[model samples]
Target: MSKNSKDTLKISGIDTSVLRIALGTWAIGGWQWGGPDDGNAIKTIHKAIDNGINLIDTAPIYGFGHSEEIVGQALKGKREKIVIATKAALNWTDDKEKIFRDARPERIRKEIEDSLRRLKTDYIDLYQIHWPDDKTSIEETAMELEKLRQEGKIKAVGVSNFSVEQMKSIQHFTQLSAIQPPYNLFEREIENDVLPYAKEHSLAVLCYGPLCRGLLSGKMIKDRVFQGDDLRKTDPKFSTSVFDNYLAATEELTQFAKDTHNKTLLALAVRWVLDQYQGNIPLWGARKPEQIEGIRDALGWSLSANDLKTIDEILAKHIKNPISPEFMAPPNR
Candidate 1:
């Protein structure tokens, strides 16, 4: 890849809005923290921003705001240059603006204030609702978000973990500028509706878990038991029987990555998500500085149409079982 091509890709038809490769901070401040090796985590955060990663995605529940604090510390001087996207908790009542347990309007406002304080910034670039809450209607939550945007507290409004129907429901009330969904080689559920809806509406789709939570990283052994409170242990794909099969598939895919015009497995993984044309940007969570370097290495290059086709064929051949049965279904329903 050439340096000239860096930042050449756009996120949502916005010329300056290139792939906002986001760094998920949950690992830094949550399950992976205090594991005797935080130097790489902190170093990777700083390095990712320096490499033109404009977006950093985090949430209050990620170590209960510790992730935001870490991001703030990492972005101390360059805060204005990067976009910090965080989420409001998911427990607000539909009729009430205040969150009694998780996301009352008052609590949302308070949480935003606290997040801003911790981030050492005046306003957030994108403030997203973490997840849907049956207690509250998305309309009310979206209205509150719009209010905050108008007040200049948040520049954009986004949502995370919203299904196609849920996204359409919220769209009825407000312009949903963005959506963060877990999408990867193994997970193809969003392709049915979320991707098309986002494209039709000009919404930027920030994809989290782009590497299938490290399953597609071309790393990990069958006997690998997760240490500490890592979420991967609970993931169905990570089980010994399932993981071995996943690994074999990843190995075949990794070779395609190597042979198909020369990109690492990591690069190919990132490219697969970015290549999805629904204004997609892959949210890359790096625990080590080298991981950030791996992402950066993917920059300034793109997969050709033939390469993409080959990749599709390879995925179809190898990922036989798919992540889940629902993954094959259309999201429109």
Candidate 2:
């Protein structure tokens, strides 16, 4: 693959240069983030694509397929300009309360058709397994995904929230070219294993949650109540004492960003992620058009080694007892 720009990545089988940042649609799905507004969601999608972001990272379980429906609606005319990426392997019941892993071959067959219909596209640029299904062998899932590729339903096979061993298992069976793992300033667990492995294997790495679920955005006010179905309500980081730690870190980080880099905390967080690995594309989540504006700040600069050290020192100063995002994983049934 040939890349002409440092700001873009050449994903396998795709001719276009995918932007270094992707639009994450989980928040707009309105499932775990409260609820969705179709009009604004459509606007946000258009704005991101129009602003030069060519990659969209979404999933079937997000808002129970509502997000894809909106994405389908938004991409009616701009379809060719965007590299639509969505995921499967997770299933949900009618009550909207229970969701679990289900990567049976039969399930993936149905998932491709359903996703194609919902996305209003004849082919998907990338099809990803959302999570590892303990009940289904990785080889079984890879064979089914490879079948879809053979049928021209999907251009490339990808995996999310998967370990290096699981990814190797998929490679043993068929093509596995891309991987999406939780990666951000505070959540850098992938650096130890996934990043090195992906870099060695020439796999695309789409790092999600660059803003750490909006915590790095420097907008979460103290004592703010996240009512409704907001995931923050139960997130361990947002609990009383821990939240105070985050609050202080956010404030200091915000000041550090403004004073040192003349950038917002959101931009600092995103650029930090991108600088970790030149090819690493951080997925930025946004539910509104205004939320997309700050991304411009993230791209125009690079962080220095000294600055990185200072940032780490600041995080260590306040964010004691840091946590990972593993709690959000769905149980395999």
How far does residue 284 in candidate 1 sit from its true spot (Å)? 1.1
Each prediction's TM-score versus the true structure: 0.86, 0.97
lDDT of 1 by residue, 295-333 (tens): 666666677888878877877776677765232221210
Q: Which candidate is the best by TM-score?
A: 2
Query: Native-vs-model 1 lDDT?
Result: 0.72
Name the weakest run of 10 consecutive residues (lDDT summed) in model 2: 1-10
Model 1 lowest lDDT segment of ten: 324-333
- lDDT by residue (tens digit), candidate 2, 1-333: 113266688898777779898999999899988889888999999889877799998899989899889899999988888899999899987897899999999999888889899999999999999999999998889999988898899999999999999998899988887999999878888989999999898889989888888799878888788879888887888866788888898899899999998999998999898888877889989999988897678886788999999999988999877899988899887
lDDT of each: 0.72, 0.88
Query: Which regions of candidate 2 fall more than 4 Å away from where they truly are?
Result: 1-4
How accurate locally is residue 103 in candidate 2, as Cα lDDT from 0 to 100? 96
Model 1, residue pairs in steric clash: 94-135, 94-136, 97-105, 98-104, 98-105, 99-103, 99-104
Give candidate 1 regions above 4 Å deviation: 1-18, 32-39, 91-103, 325-333
